[model samples]
Target chain A: MVIYGVALLSFCMLVGVFLGDLLGELIGVQANVGGVGIAMLLLILLSNLTSQRFSLAPMTESGIHFWSAMYIPIVVAMAARQNVVAAVSSGWMAIIAGVAAVAASFLLIPVLSKAGRGRPE
Target chain B: MSGDVLARVLTENSLIAAFVVVGALVMVSYWLSARLTRGHIHGSAVAIALGLLLAYAGGVATGGSKGLADIGVFAGIGIMGGAMFRDFAIVATAFGAELEALKKAGLVGALSVVIGVVLSFVVGALVALAFGYTDAVSVSTIGAGAATYIVGPVTGTALGASSEVVALSIAAGLTKSVLVMIGTPLVAGRIGLDNPHSAMIYGGLMGTTSGVAGGLAATDPKLVPYGAMTATFYTGVGCLLAPSVLYLVVRAVL
Candidate 1:
């Protein structure tokens, strides 16, 4: 039951995201990715609420299993793309970009900290 | 060549191979993560890995160049899938929790998170307009959840544009890095010794939404710069991290 629950949730969320994307395209209103995110989030909330109202055990955490396992095949394939990655010569750019970004993140963290400072009370 | 091997793999028995390979990898990651993290592994990672595998298999079988572009595209789309998948999980899990009377009130609790996502998008969109960047939907997902999956691929797509995707992705990475760096501090300020991480998370969510909203809103076609900046800032940190992330994978091959 737990396993099925998690699977059901995942499937629903996937459908929601896909649907949201399609909706955005069809409506031409441009809700952005948040539409899908919000949709899935709402679905999860709804599913959990409905299940509880009926008294069911929480869904299994199998999606985590499914998610973690995906990397192996990707890494393996990327391993196969070594030569293409090598020829790019853009490695330096990536490095520079990475360093700069990291540095920016470091700087931004404190600024955000300062900016976010407040208590509703 | 690897491509030839993939071709053979596909021609001989592609569907079976894909199933077996993906299933095995999923199990392996599950086992490893469960064993190491004690079942704490994230579903997003698994989804990403699956997306990459599927993309690669499809690309290779179809004779697409096994180049950065193909892989990057795979990664971008995978990120999109992964992000949505996680959102689904979060919502589902929350719902499951509510159903079983595990914790938190049902609708109200769920609404809190939904509200967060919406507010994040509004802020992200405004910020993008102020900064000047592209108005792609991928940018909208930045702050939503597990946007890393979308960020890389978005950058890949940006490369195909006249603006250059790598640069854009790298820019996105930089933005994330900045968000993370400043996010900690920013949240600290607002929450007042509360969970600083949450603030950063919210910021990221907002940043990405801002990008997407801004991008779509910038239909004039001249607001590309604003859209790009908005998009990059939202996913900047993730994009910047792409090189090293990909480098590590490439390094393993060597």
Candidate 2:
């Protein structure tokens, strides 16, 4: 079940990454350009448009949907590789100040969420 | 062959070894997620925390700039954790969402994105002022960094902030991203972030695309799109504000 789902995701990823890289090279950013977003669009297309043609099992469909949505292991990989030390060594003040700033933003989530409630237009 | 030869072999074929190392870490993280936190916390959160801890420690131990990726055996981490893979994972989330569901976010969702940008910027500016970055460029660059890493550079370039300051801003943004990723699931239940509306708000407020998506993924795979969609808006708003209106405000303040 997951195999087919992964195949679909992987197919999207390869094409997305390639196009993103090409776009980046064209734009001179030396990085992938909107590959993830492009791949996401492709995935949404396939998941929605081709579902009828494929007739995948419900578990397979959900499995594709599940990993498509979150997939935290990759997040961990990205987070783990960040150069926190380099950032820290640049300025202890920056790290401390940045933490305080982000913490404040975190605290404000509830206020914003509440302020936004009880209205539908 | 001896252990030396075995070590050399592993070092030479480091990509597979890196995957092995990461697989082991994820495996352990999930087990701890189940055993220690009883799955109240997702393995991704635990794994990210452990990753930060390990990377910080490893960076200090070797005094290397790239953290764990500096090690030969762990070198493939640069590829595994780099932007390409990160974006790849992020894009896949598109599959989970329905366009029609966006209607549910409504006006409040739009307001959240706008407010979330200013909210993060103001907090970052205040903190920057509190610290020793008394100059407008330094203060605003760091402040913009708090909005998101991308905004930091965009603002810095527009303001002509020194590259060192821009680097610091990037660092600041990276820190925020990690914080959001780890913090989301821990506070999701208490904050009533289970549904798509709240998820959109959370994404707007957090405004770091990767962090929001990752956190929401761990919390609820279905909610990733809502959070990421607004978080994308938040980035756009941050980019627009931090360089122009926000920069002028900082100049006036400092």
True interface contacts reproduced by each model, as a fraction?
0.09, 0.55
After superposition, candidate 2 runs with Cα above 4 Å error: A1-42, A51-70, A87-92, A115-117
Assess each prediction's global lDDT (C-alpha) against the native. Answer: 0.36, 0.73
| DockQ of the candidate models in sequence | 0.16, 0.42
Candidate 2 per-residue lDDT over residues B2-51, each given as its tens digit? 98887787788876776777778889999999999998788777787787
Model 1 iRMS (Å) reads: 10.7
The TM-score that candidate 1 achieves is 0.41
Q: What digit string (tens of lDDT, one per residue) describes model 2 on residues A17-100?
A: 688667756744433444555576678777777776866677666656665533566666666676768656666655665576
lDDT of candidate 1 over B91-157, digit per residue (tens): 3323322222212122222332333233332333233333443444323322112233245444345
